[model samples]
Target: MLRETWAEIDPGRIVDNLRAIRGTLPAGVKLMAVVKANGYGHGDLEAAEAARQAGADYLAVAFLEEALRLRAGGVTLPILILTPIRPDQAELAASQELTLTVTDAAWFRELRKGRPAPAPGGRKLRVHVKADTGLGRIGFRTEAEWDALVPWLAAPDIDVDGFYTHFATAGQADTAYLERQACRFAELMERCKASGIAVRHYHCAGSAAALRFPGLALDMVRIGAAMYGYYPPQLTPPVQLKPALSLHSTLMQVKRVRRGEYLGYDNAYRSDADEWIGTVPIGYADGWSQRMRGADVLVRGRRAQVVGKISMDQLMIRLPGPCAPGDRVTLIGRQGGERITFAELAVHIDGAAQEISTALTDRVHRICANEKEVQCPWSSPYFQPHRREATVI
Candidate 1:
């Protein structure tokens, strides 16, 4: 890429992670690879292909557009839209043979008004009913809501593909809330049985919950963060997953600052003593916001604290010693024995590992480390120069 900042992704690691999680699952339990948010900013098509290589049974995206993008990219695996779509959009979703998430009966009623024409080969409009057992986001909450939705789901024009819920405390130390949500989901499953609504797949656990509690893996598990190797170890998961994404950049400039001198806007940082300072070509606009002021990167395999309020396109870091403008900077990866992880950055930002990765803007280029294993989707005339060999984003 023309820029010095870039993210290196190893699609092979994603494949390995899915395989590791699969080995821990019971036989016959399907794995739904969640590649929403452009595969959490590691490139959606790349993540989907990796999931396919690892034998994933299904793929899931957050919305209709994401599913359509995947289809355009030639991803044919059964794709489920995790978020509910507008009723008017049903036809488009149906035409693409994409499974949609539904919350209430009213949505179904509206969808039926303009029933989507059968897709190529007469494929039914597949859907997954989401129950709000917890998390308090987009789902039918009570039995009344489910009862109202039952009749619409029974229509022959629709296919009850799956039933699922999201857990809010899956990665937390406390299990009380998670257990409560699990119990509620079980109640909903029983309600489905009583209503004669057969669902092809029944899933509740996300990556953290799935790895921490295998017994809860009813018919399938939606693996997202764990598949990308960002799940926290505190959950005591059975498998080990390695991160597939790492950030790297070159120091654009370096100089010495006197103890009394200040740097950055409004003097957000002041030199404690005569020290070497380096400017990195990444900042808030590039997803490294001011909240990362206290965060650190690695220079020459040594820790360097980010100093001052991060600018829109640049950030300053206190160097260990004198460093050249072309020296490598490790933002989210290993440098010798020292390493900077997403978890560490998350602590500073008070968010999840995904919040850090997903926040990464497209301005920072991406390079696939093992392009030989998974062909880069952007290898076309549009991305020019070294088309056959270069995998850039």
Candidate 2:
């Protein structure tokens, strides 16, 4: 089945973005590509593979399941789980050789009690201690809390692989808060070092910090949005990034609307004059939100305004002129001389480009394009396209 709506992922573009980011890093600084949220909705396995090929030293995800998915997909790089895992999940995570993050000392004690014994001839579970600094979401918030974890760090059942922290305002123009967070993290690191608890990888820089404040790129950096060609609006990336994902769909129907005719649900839009209208087989269910009613989509390489309330599986676009079904529509990519960027879409939703990309639903097929050819699940032998002419709905 040839799906009308799909997201095209360019691995080459991802590699380019990774390379660009790496180019800006100081020598010996490692890049840990963050592939959480299904690689920001770009397909985790595909994105991780591309990042690995581009020389990412590590890969990070937010959950144990994501790390397991990567391992199952043959990802051999060091995979770190950024989020804390339950005591019950610690053994399974360790069994898969996934690096787990430790936040609270008491929680660590509980995990240690429930954690399964190490496998035969297997190494101890690798762990990274997280310092909360100022994020206030997770990790040890003070020296006392961190000191409480020192015994667990020295336990024979676990190996302390790293220590890290997160920044709350690394991407903003105002660096006061970010500086304070950095200072706190530094103080914690010094305390750890003085206490003879040191790890190889000491990192705090995420994508924003890595790009804006290279000094914070201690041992490694966790890069997410910038690796996918996006950054917060307030900060400028040090290197150019090539977007790896492009959303596209085919027009399913085309019709002539008479003057004063209402379109879509609730009769939200009324045509002021007889005009060409197109129905695209994509809508809120596919991550196109209802708030995008006034946004523009590319039709035949020309901009066409979204005309009415977005539906569950379809939406109406005001075409420039008479058009037929099966015409190509570009939602987030280049179309002839025009382009609809993630930044522009973010403006419509008043969110970051990262949110826009990650919000894309799974109903949309992910077609990965590389130097070889386009690979899609729909291309397999089991899939057969139905022969039917496009018709008005």
* Best candidate (score: TM-score): 1
Clashing pairs in 2: none
| Residue lDDT tens for model 2, 106-130 | 7776775766454566668799999
- List TM-scores for all candidates, in order: 0.94, 0.91
What is the overall TM-score of model 1 with all chains considered together? 0.94
Candidate 2 has an lDDT of: 0.83
**lDDT (C-alpha) at residue 149 in model 1:** 92
Quote model 2's TM-score: 0.91
Report the C-alpha lDDT of model 1 over 327-381, residue by residue, as the tens digit.
9899998888899988888887888889888889988877767744665666312
Model 2, 171: alpha-carbon shift in Å? 2.2
* Candidate 1 Cα outliers beyond 4 Å, as residue runs: 116-123, 379-393
